[model samples]
Target: MSSTDPDVDHALAYPEPPASPLWHRQGAKARPLTDAQKQRNCELLLLAQHKPRTHRRAEKPACSPT
Candidate 1:
């Protein structure tokens, strides 16, 4: 067998590579969250957008007679 070929395994004749960290792995699964927790997070984010979602803005502000 020729070792100069690109497909040839040179590590088998030497040694294997070192292991990588957990973050480096691409197949890790994330933990699931409760429905209530998810909703709370979403609501808090929406509140930051400053939209007119409160009852105080249901009607337009009274304009002064000019």
Candidate 2:
């Protein structure tokens, strides 16, 4: 069959690619967090909540002395 032929079956022409590695795969099941990890996460969340917010001041142009 001609490579340029429009009637050629492209799907059957090429070999299937190898499957992706386990680490590269997405949407895999996540393991449940340990008790220590859960407690640390809660402590971090509380600390973050109690942290003060900072406000930035507007920049002023330099004044030239006469």
Which number leads on lDDT? 2
Predicted candidate 2 versus true structure: per-residue lDDT over 1-66, tens digit per residue: 766778855675668878769648578579988877776666555555553743433243232222
Q: Give lDDT per model, in order.
A: 0.55, 0.57
> Model 2: runs farther than 4 Å from truth?
1-27, 53-66
True lDDT of residue 61, candidate 1: 31
Highest TM-score: give the candidate number.
2
Instruction: State, as a TM-score between 0 and 1, how close model 1 is to the true structure.
Output: 0.33
TM-score of 2: 0.37
Model 1, 1-66: lDDT tens digits are 667667855557667768767547567567787776676565555555546556342233333222
